[model samples]
Target: MKKYFYNNIKSKALLLTLASITLFSACEKNDDLKIAPPTTISDADIFKSPARIEGLVNGIYKALKGASLYGGRFLLYQDARGEDFINVTANNYTAYEAWNNSYSSGSNDINNLWGAAYTAINNANIVIEGLAANPGVVTAQKTSEYVAEAKLVRALAYYSLIISFGQPYNKDGGASKGVPLRLKAENGPENNNLARSSVAQVYAQIIKDLNEAEAALPQNYTSNELNTTRAHTSTAIALKTRVYLTTNQWSKVIEEAVKLVPQTQAPFSTTATAVKHALQTNIANIFASDYTSVESIFSIPMSTLDSYTGQSAIAYIYNTNSEFYVNPTGILGDAQWGSTDRRRSFLRLSSGKQFFRKYAKPSPFLDYIPVIRYAEVLLNYAEAAAKTGNLVLAQNLLRAVHQRSDASYVFPAAAISTETALIETIWKERRIEFIGEGFRGPDLLRNLQPLPAKGDSNLQTPAVPLTAENYIFPAPNTELSTNKLY
Candidate 1:
């Protein structure tokens, strides 16, 4: 509650200028100071107390809450840019452009996203450096956990950046250019001119950091601020499934997902205390204004206590809309299940007005932004296992997620008789399951699939191939101009 530093990128950037040393985390908004690294409290003075260090770490989560990052806008951008949500405002031309798959490197949304991610990555680096130095105060366990958390935060940022900015790792062995991998916590003019890492290198670093994170983090933390809001072993494993899925590491994806999600129990939470990672019965309640449920592996905490403002908020997207419309197309319309699924309870069709009920307001803007969930982990395993010739295991995993949302739903053996069919079935399930959750587009990109016909009108020029030049977001023009390497 009331975290200071992470709220805005300006203050985080100011810290870097003041320190003349490395700044940590970077997921704040700063249209003016483009390409600046993330920051924390003054190193020597702030480290005298453990509470300060804790708050600094808390700041990392706060920074991530930037509307441009996870607070809400990122989800909106992903979904709107994909096939689900349509931009109906007509006046918001940039959004329509995005829907049409034509956003440029100079696009404000692209720049905003690029800045937010680097801010988080840098902030994570700052934390890692501070924890390693120890400041001669915090306990060993605390230090290790903090360092691991930093790595996790950093990995999430880097992975997001790589996938969004460069080609998917499965494309040509990840030979494309990725955003700069700034690992060290140092501040110098030269540090600002860093080079892009190869997509493969970025993935390797993400895996390495995640491994350190998984090893150091505890099984669970009792509070939402610690467990759900922060990283834990299960959180790391959950992320590995996402990472491997994107990189096309079929075996590794199943392996990591299986580590946390049980093959038999299906939707059970793993930790002993506070029911850390189990699936809750009610599907609607998970997206309500209250704190996250057992299925929440990692999420950014948002609520009436800490409300989101501006266009980025979920409340703005679904609730206050003359701008965007909740429209699920492509795979959903193709898969007959979307019409009858029980999870459609999350949607509302009143007086011909349709919008998702997940962040509906009377509750205003209090949804705890989901980063990943048990359902996704199961789906990831299902996809990976199917690809790896484990049809039985794949069917079981897919059904676990399916049955949770629609009790009447069942997968027949003929539905997934072959490995190709199983993979296709699981992929379609993801399209329905994650609708409006900003995953549909990335799901297409990573799978090397085509765009589902970009929202009818602006894309009338013969649907752009998913392989178009601007398919993935380009690196921010600001970063390209600032760096000598470009």
Candidate 2:
């Protein structure tokens, strides 16, 4: 989990350096003497060797683990924007602006997140282009796998950016403007003036990349660790389920989901060809020491040497320092979430305040940040089944996720008697299961639901309606300052 070469670049100037081919020279006075080794390697040299090429591929994953991206802040900001959590410290360095729904184009979180995501995207683009330019550097099969891996990472990064900066696709059928789509490698400032694409256009590219990646990616890696951390066939299919779910493509969701998740019964899992992903018998094991569990479809690996610093870790913000705590009157107050439910084990009370313990790691906070899980895929399939008039299959899918945590709890007859009630029950299960995992904001926006308000005596924020300007994050000032077309 060591930080790769790409993590050192922190600003836009350094970001543009990704495509630069640095050269070294020595003075004539030292012509007779041996020249010192060059400090930087050219991008061309990197793709000439298999090891260096693999390093470039790993760099894409490293970029996603930045604190402002998926590592912590992205998850923290998404949860803070929802109603399930109340700000404890109101610390600006944390997600205060996001919790209050008051962030503007100039906000630090907005700019940093936008920068980090695009940095990852650019790194992926460089890998794809560099590998293609240098053919026969590796076997054709290995080359295809490497390029497909990069495409998957690029697709994930674009999906994150479009959902954050642009309006939800379900709102206007993706007719509104989305983030700028950068496909080629940007070695200089010439491409900085590219205009934003439509939301539908972005999604179409995302699906296209995913489909290509799915066809080329390996069914499974050699080990459990690689299977959980790297892009594979199941990984791409699991993500498609989520993307299709967001766009309200029910049949597409079901079509993509069943590739990985079998539709049979309670113990749902993939076949031996793909990674064996199933719900952990105990809900807590996924967050504990066993990070390489089959349940994790894909996650950003973290370790003591390469982990979030200061308050950037999710554990520090929610568990250690207590910057935010669970909202009593929010989802936790729902009577349907029984007191005896095993999922309640994730909740902890300290000094009369309840906080989420899903990210329970201490100090360096070496918990792997989950990008997608099997439970989520199951729930996504369940929702899609319910929407497409397959209630029997939907109920079976819902029961698999629910009973895995609480074996004795039963869905009341009224709860599953109708299509509407069953769908509502599935939604509630998602909120409880993914409370601190960053699905809250996306869940609200995908359905065009308003962001509900929540606070204590210290602060009170209003609900942001669908028509409000703050419903979605604005394009960052950094992009506007450089991209003239924006």
Candidate 3:
């Protein structure tokens, strides 16, 4: 686990050095605290020197380990809002469940998200600034690749901010104030009063960063682990596909999806392990354990002992307290999960409340929290194909996942008959297929689709009205109070 965190530092450091170059004034302190020497180096001096340039780039990936972003908080808040689980105590997740005004400026969710995302964005900005100042430090090709990777990460951070703060940042009645745009290191007071950019401007920035990332990143990195871990050209493409699709750029969505189809390069296309990839072979293992299968395209590694236990804490809070039998509460249980599907075993009811068995053990374990996966790529292809009048292709894709799950349930011919129906079919499949993994709500709202109240059988809680306002969380009080932009 330590190895996983440390390994990426090399690349991250190199990236950070590039960013710092533009933001900081070079100054070295004198031993007697009298006169100091200028820390600034000649462009030739820094570029001619190999060691420091590499160190800064490596710093970028290290920042990802921060708890506010991928380190843990990001995935937790996202999962909390989706349809799969309801917050009973409603402690941290009250606003999400009620779809009410509970998530005001003072809400923890709002504040945490705001802080974490900017932390990531600022880190990326610093990297970009530094690289801009000393372009000659690395080969032109390598430098560009680093630049692209940094931008991709920044875009990803902003995308998270845009969606959480408000959907369609630039769209009608959107969150009037979006996330702050930090292009340089905010190391002092002048940077503190930054204001929010409009949703439109945020989206534009996101697109710009992604476009640069796609161009700069290599088709694939040489390092095996890093290839799977870090943002690549494919990651940028996949994210842009999502962003375009969300903003209703249907044509561009299809174009990006097409580019991504061949790039996913894994069990994505092969039918041999299709079921396995979707956890059809053992649904319990897929959801309940830290199984890093091929379907996982991007994720954060969280170890019990080495770092904070986000997943475990969630499991414990959601579950009930019964020693022998752990049952999920009525608010969060599938009636059929226990009887027929093996996946039900992932949670056991304890004292009438459903407790996730995945991370319930007394001891700690290694868990990798997912950021993205190949399943998304497959789904994107299906959606794009369906939009392009290739209903058969889309139907085949849905059927593949369903058929992979239960051979006994007959495939429906109606599943892929029309674009409208195909979209609905795909949405339902995603809800069931990615349950507890956190893609459901956004998947529905981003497309401007109607959501059934909690009671709709497919949605399955009790019918409740959730509106577009539910999509945009309130600005954290801290941001509103301290930052002029909000």
Candidate 4:
């Protein structure tokens, strides 16, 4: 897979350069390139045809596959930064630096994330330019829709950077400093010395892209299961819900989620059959050999045999020595996971430390790491409704997700009666439901909630309040060196 990636870089950059446009290929070799003599494909010719446009759009998805967002590295960055997953395991020790401490300078994972996400943004910008220059490239409805999909992904990549490295859009940190914005297809001296835009501006771009994306995207591309690979209207809406909540745009959160829920999609919501949440009920099924689970809205494809490079966070959680596997016990016990539950089988050990088996692959193939899921949408609605004083609606949504996890369990009527309790319950369910996934850090940061100390195993224990200032991660040294923005 790495070789395939390398070859694509060589060809695409050459093709784009020959086509007379600034190239931003993520797979492109990280070396200096001199603009060569022009060839057959002109800037006019590149986007004038549908094939070229399709190729450019395909690059957007390909860039997204860069190690920063997926390809193993992003997974580690997310875990190391979150309250879950301690680096007791020696795997990827540098990653533990960023997770445990917000201010990391020379961390490779941090550096890689900044570079890769920027590369994706550049590719998106190139495509948007092409679409504008050559409107004829997408005459058909499907092609046009795909163009919108590209915009959504581009927005997503930028938002990832903003939330992690900077601050929420409406906060003081956001106003003070943010990451640089690259919205053109230029590869010259002029590209240097650009300053960081305020988080407000960055979010403005994100919103613009998503607003257009929501309009162009389909209701659901291929149902909840298969839709994990593709972007749809609901994913965009759900993402917006998160973005707005981060920026304290409560009205927007409520508005976006309302638009999303009524879509009434499967896996997105279960039937009364009590089988709705059964998909992830086994716990182990969430990380099964099958990547296309019913709950995953979108994920990075990891192959055990070929594509498995190993995620740093997963490696740290499960200590993997040559002869034996070590698991660090975090929240679950062996009995809690149960021998029958696949998650427990893979993630738990009788030895004091419990390691996660979900991401464990002896071969090169890794499990499909989820980026978005239907479960998040449910949680989003529950939180938004609870915040808006809609306790009944929020409780029902919370119960919908919780009931799916353990079908036999029931919530007392009084427990569901109040807004605060229901909100807290929904939050707890989110912590459990999305553990080991990347959402915890952002979820905590966005809600202005506190990070749990190592001692707070019982999630119900009260947490010290965290603020928006805690949301901004210090810019890595590499970025600071290249662009004095930090």
Q: What is the C-alpha lDDT of each candidate?
A: 0.69, 0.82, 0.55, 0.59
- Return the lDDT, model 1, position 479: 73
Candidate 1: tens digits of C-alpha lDDT, residues 235-302: 88899999999988998997787677654445444543333566667667777643456677777765
> TM-scores across all candidates?
0.87, 0.92, 0.74, 0.77
Task: Please report the TM-score between candidate 1 and the true structure.
Answer: 0.87
- Candidate achieving higher lDDT, 1 or 4: 1
Which residue runs of candidate 1 sit more than 4 Å off their true CA positions?
A: 1-12, 16-41, 91-94, 264-276, 334-340, 350-353, 362-364, 412-414, 456-462
Point out the worst 10-residue segment of candidate 2 by lDDT. Answer: 23-32
Off by over 4 Å in 2: 1-11, 15-38
Q: For model 1, how big is the CA root-mean-square deviation?
A: 5.7
What digit string (tens of lDDT, one per residue) describes model 4 on residues 5-36? Answer: 11112222323543333222211221111233
Q: Give per-residue CA lDDT, model 3, range 234-307, as digits (tens).
A: 67777887787667666787677666454332233423221122323554554445334445545555443334
lDDT of 4 at 68: 59
Where is model 3 more than 4 Å wrong at Cα? 1-55, 93-101, 169-177, 262-293, 303-306, 310-345, 349-354, 357-365, 449-471
Question: Which has the greatest lDDT?
Answer: 2
Q: Local error of candidate 1 at 200, Å? A: 0.5
Q: Write the per-residue lDDT of candidate 2 for residues 1-486, one digit (tens) a residue.
A: 111222112223442222222111011221111223434555546778776676667667777766899887898888898999999787878999999999998888998899888888877888898888999989999999988998999899899888888899999999999988988766666677878999999999999999999999999877777788789998899999999999999999998888887646767888744677888887788888777789999887776446786778888888888888889898889866678878787889987878888888888777888999999999999999999889998899998888877778889989987899999999988998888888999999999999998899998899999999999998888888778787
